[model samples]
Target: MIPTTDDPIGDNPALIVIDPQQTTSESEEAMSSGAASIPGGRDAVMENINTVVEHARSADIPIIWGKELHRPDFADYGAEIESCEPEHGIVGTRAEQFDPILSIDEDDMEPAEYVIVKRRYNFFHRTDIEHILRTYDIDTVILVGFMTNICVHYTAHGAHEHDYAFRVAEQATAAPSQDLHETGLKCMRYLQPRGIQDITDITARLEEYDGNQLVKRVKESGQITPKTGPV
Candidate 1:
């Protein structure tokens, strides 16, 4: 449901952008069929990702960009390394890079915003995300990014298990097919009734984020700065 005037996404929310670097910016058509393929098109989904990111940035919400990086020798990928067709997020490959469409380091972007690298489908596994969230007292997680059925789905599960109230920008995430996309949303919704919502609704809630006055405390602890002002 689209949140009405009052937003339940909470005041201490962090926007977790899961693998926006699914493809190189040069391959626009990868949205249809490729290792980077994302159903419902690529550019539009990416645009939504950026729009929500900007909203978070403007409202002092934390933006955690999850990058699925693997070792060059594939030793860290586990058994998938020996699979005939393995995950494409191998560290040195273009598939593991941030899409060129993203402005990762812009003047308007906050200096404290993070790019977190992980090897598992779930961000919480072997990543500093939980510690980071705890450092900032973040209790709410809003997810947006590529492959709704894969990384996004598992990350939502991780968030749920971690006891963080989470929501997924349903329209902001995509999969290789519409079936998978819808199924992914259903799974998340099953886990948390209000977990699936539109990006517009999510951003509306995000615009209300004022750092809950916790930003200063976290920064003093050397954890992270709550975004404020123009960034």
Candidate 2:
């Protein structure tokens, strides 16, 4: 079921932008097979993503950017599974950089915002992303960015396992094809089921709560008690 306006899950959600980097040859091959590509290509999706970023920045919400980076040696099996290899120069290369159109200036990025580098599709896999969220005491995660079916979808699924209240910005994420994009969204909706609202609704919900105040509420309400689990 879609979460309501009164649902505390959507309050003070962190924006997770995934794999907004320049496309590689391997990535293009994956796209041609109807598996992964930024829906409507880079130009169209980046525009919408920029708008999401601007809104999040204006609201002072935490924005976590995720990218896939491989080491010089193919020591990381996760990269191989995702078809991101150093031989192909898919990761740890200039092509792995965020698209320039997004205006992601390092200087302008807030200190609270995190840039997580992962070797796999799931941002939480073998990464410190979940720990960072736990440290900040964030519950909700608003997912955005490229190749909707792959990185973005995997990250959202991982969030579900971690019990994070999550939503995906429909317009802000794209796949190589319409079928894959819709399929990914449907899968995410099935998994979490609760916080599947659009970006517009999400932004409106976030506007109701000031930054960090929602965390305070969750703490006071005892929704997040002393737990030893990853959450």
Candidate 3:
């Protein structure tokens, strides 16, 4: 069973939106094509993520967008893993930019607000993500985005290692295959050990927890402030 946190989520939770780039790989193509042919496909997953994004925005929580991008010359080790580097303009290319379906507005694109250009599966690796979270005093992380088995899984692992209170939006993530998706969820359910809430449940939980009120209540009661610093 997933563990729960006594400190209300509103006390400052960060939303990490991971790897929702374009689809270009064969597996992704198969999934997208199959989804198009079926009643629900790629679009269904994107819509769910968008819904979660809206909820996070309404709650005034920070939304951190992480996209995988590599250098053109494979100067980074990521290119060593594959023959051809992930080019800039190719669809699903790490450099292709955020998926438009996410509906992130111009205001949400502020530099301080989002963590972009993540080259690896784990957002904290060689990135300012940890620093940003520390700067914002965010303790809990709600992870949502694409390719559940790969990037999502890696990020959650990193979060757990860093001792951050972590949550995954189950419905908001998509994998190349249903089996992979289910396996990823099972791994997160066991590995994460805390706050593995469904997208709907998390949305409602965020709405119910008022951050300002919680902060005020904690302060007024003369309670010792829980360390809001990095894990």
> Compared with the true structure, what per-residue lDDT tens digits does model 2 show for residues 83-175?
532233255566567778886876665546678888778888989987768666677888888667777888988888887777887777877
**Preferred candidate (TM-score higher): 1 or 3:** 1
- How much does candidate 3 score in TM-score? 0.75
Pairs of residues clashing in candidate 1: none
Q: How would you encode candidate 1's per-residue C-alpha lDDT over 77-172 as one tens digit per residue?
A: 886566443456766668766777775763443544788898888988889998778866787788888668778889999988888777888767
What candidate 3 gets wrong by more than 4 Å, as runs, is 1-11, 25-39, 77-95, 106-112, 212-231
lDDT score of residue 164 within candidate 2 = 78
Q: Global lDDT of each model?
A: 0.72, 0.68, 0.66
Candidate 3 residue lDDT tens string, 1-231: 122454335356878988777655543454341121123656777787788877776666667887776555556645436633223323335336666777775454632346567767787777888876775577788888766777788888887777677788777777667777777777887875555666778888778765533334334553325565788
Q: Model 1, which residues run further than 4 Å from truth?
A: 1-8, 22-40, 81-86, 106-109, 216-231
TM-score of 2: 0.76
Greater lDDT among 2 and 3 belongs to 2
Which is the winner by lDDT between candidate 1 and candidate 3? 1
Model 1: number of clashes?
0
Clash-forming residue pairs, model 2 = 37-176, 39-175
**Candidate maximizing TM-score:** 1
Instruction: Give the deviation of candidate 3 from the true structure as CA RMSD.
Output: 6.8
Clashes of each: 0, 2, 1
Candidate 1 residue 192 C-alpha distance from true site, Å: 0.5
